[model samples]
Structure formats: structure tokens, C-alpha cells
Target: MTDRELFDTYRRDVYYLCHYMLHNAADAEDICQEVFLKAFQTDRQGVERIKPWLLRIAVNMCKSHLDRRKRGVLKELKHFLLERRRDTEAADEALERKENELETERWLRALPVKNRTVMTLRYIHELSLQEIAETLDIPPGTVKSRLNRGLRQMRRDLGKSNPNLKGAECLE
Candidate 1:
């Protein structure tokens, strides 16, 4: 497929992967552009599956981006921690929703890169274990192991933060 066609087909998937992986929309957009640019430059003669191949590139790019921006991410984390909630009833509901999203984001970000990537690809993207393996260039067993370990870590973290938190058991 032509570059335009490929971008059209995979843009949303690529953007979503980058967004969830990075938890930043602007960074996601930049990385999405870079992904297509890299894809356009590379020859795809032997690539058996385009989606997995593209995702693998995105994953690598996000990892690299995260590594380079470790300080910035930490700063953002601090900002999230310092942010205060509003007190109005309407704001309370909105604040609750935002808090839930922030909590989930924090949990995902706390995971190691491999574990985070595997979990995002498996749950957010809804890829099968085999598909995650292919996208991550790892064995299916590794994918399962990471998923289990990541879930365990998330559960542990949540329990420590909120003892009454429900649905954590469903992770197992």
C-alpha cells in the first residue's frame, strides 16, 4: 500500500497505541507522524503483517521517547500528585472520573516498559496473546508472564492505595 493509504488505515491504531503508551496526546501525535515517516522510508518487501510491524515500530519509538523524557515524565507525575480537587457536587463527579483515569494512568506508568506495553496491547488494544507476542517480538509465554506480573503489581498497588477497591480480583 502507498504511504497515504497506510497512514489512513493505521493512523487511529498508531495514535491510540502512542497515546496510551505515553499518556500524552501531543507526544502521541508527534510519534504517530514519526512512525509513518519511518514506515515510509523502510522497505516492506518481507513484512508478513503490516499492523504488527507498524505497532512494533511504535512500541520501540515510545520506549525510546519515554527513556529520553524520564525527567519530564517524573515532573508530570509530581504535577499530578500536587493537583487539587474541586468541591462542588458537579465538580465532585467530574473529579471522581478524572481521579479514576489518573489512578489507572499512574498504575500503568508504574509498570516496567515491557510489562506496560504488553498490558496496553493486550487490554487497551485487545490484541491476542500471540498478537502481542508478535508485536513485541517476544514469545507468547513471555507475554502471558508479563501480563500476570503486571496485573499482580497493579493489584498490589491499588490495594495499598485503596483497600476497598473492587474488581482487582478480575485481573486474575
Candidate 2:
């Protein structure tokens, strides 16, 4: 496909994937642009599945960006905390829901990259186990183990913070 076609077809998916991975809209946009630029500059004549190919590019770009700077999580937490203040202007119910969502995001952020990626792909993006394995270039068994470990960690963290949280026991 031409560059324009590629961008039109996959721009939203790429952007969301980057945003989900990085939790920063501006960085996601920059990486999305870079992903397409790289795709355009290279030869993709033999690419069989564009979705996975593009996603792999996005994943690598996000990993490199994270590795270059260790403070990304702190920056994102700060951004979320600041954003939470803005939510206070909304209705009480909405504010409560937003808080819960933010709390979930925080928990997800605490996870290691591999676990976070697997969970995001499996739950948020609703990919099958096999698809996640292919996307991450790992075996399905490894994906399962990482997902189990990640969930256990999240449960442990949540349990320590809030013993009454409903889903902590479900993680067992």
C-alpha cells in the first residue's frame, strides 16, 4: 500500500496502541508519525500482515522511548494526578468513576513492561493468546505465565492498599 493509504488505514490503531503503551498522547502521536515514516522509507513488499507488522513497530518504538528515559512512569503519574484535579469540577458520580479509572491506570502502570504489554493486548485490545504471543514474539505459554504473574502482582498491590477491593480475591 501507499504511504497515504497505510496511514489512513492504520493511523487510529497505531495511535491508540502507542497511547496505551506510553500513556502520553503527544508521545503517541510522535511515535505514530515515526512508525509511518519508517514504514514509508522501507520496503514492505513482502509484509503479509500489516496490523501485526505496524504494531510491532509501535511496540519497539515505545520500548526504546521508555528505555531512553527512566522517568516516564513518574511523568505519567504526575500528569494523571494533575488531570485528576480537573475532574473535580465534574458531577460527584462522574468524579468517582474517573477516580476508579485512574486508580486502575495507576495499578497497570506499576506493572513491568512485559506484563503490562501482555495484559493490555489480552484484555484491553482483546487479542487472543496466540495473537499476543505472535505480537510479542514469545510462546503462548510464556504469555500465560506473564499474565498470571502480572495479575498476581496487581492483586497483591491492590490488596495491600485496599483490603476491601472486590476483585483482589478473584485474582487467586
Top TM-score hit: 2
Q: Give lDDT tens digits, candidate 2, residues 1-172.
A: 8889999998877787888767788988999999999989989988877777788888888878877867454223222233546646667877776777687778878988778788777776667788788778899999999999888888888888877766636354
Model 1, runs deviating above 4 Å:
19-27, 43-46, 64-96, 164-172
Position 140, candidate 2: lDDT? 97
Instruction: Count steric clashes of candidate 2.
Output: 0
Candidate 2 collision pairs: none
* Model 1, span 1-172: residue lDDT tens: 9888899998988987887667788998999999999999999888888888899899889879988987234211212322345444476687776777688878988988678778777776668898899988889999999999999898989888877667745343
Tell me the TM-score of each prediction against the true structure: 0.68, 0.70
In model 2, which runs have C-alpha deviations exceeding 4 angstroms? 1-5, 20-24, 41-48, 68-93, 165-172
Q: What 10-residue stretch in candidate 1 is worst by lDDT?
A: 74-83
The per-residue C-alpha lDDT of model 2 at residue 78 equals: 20
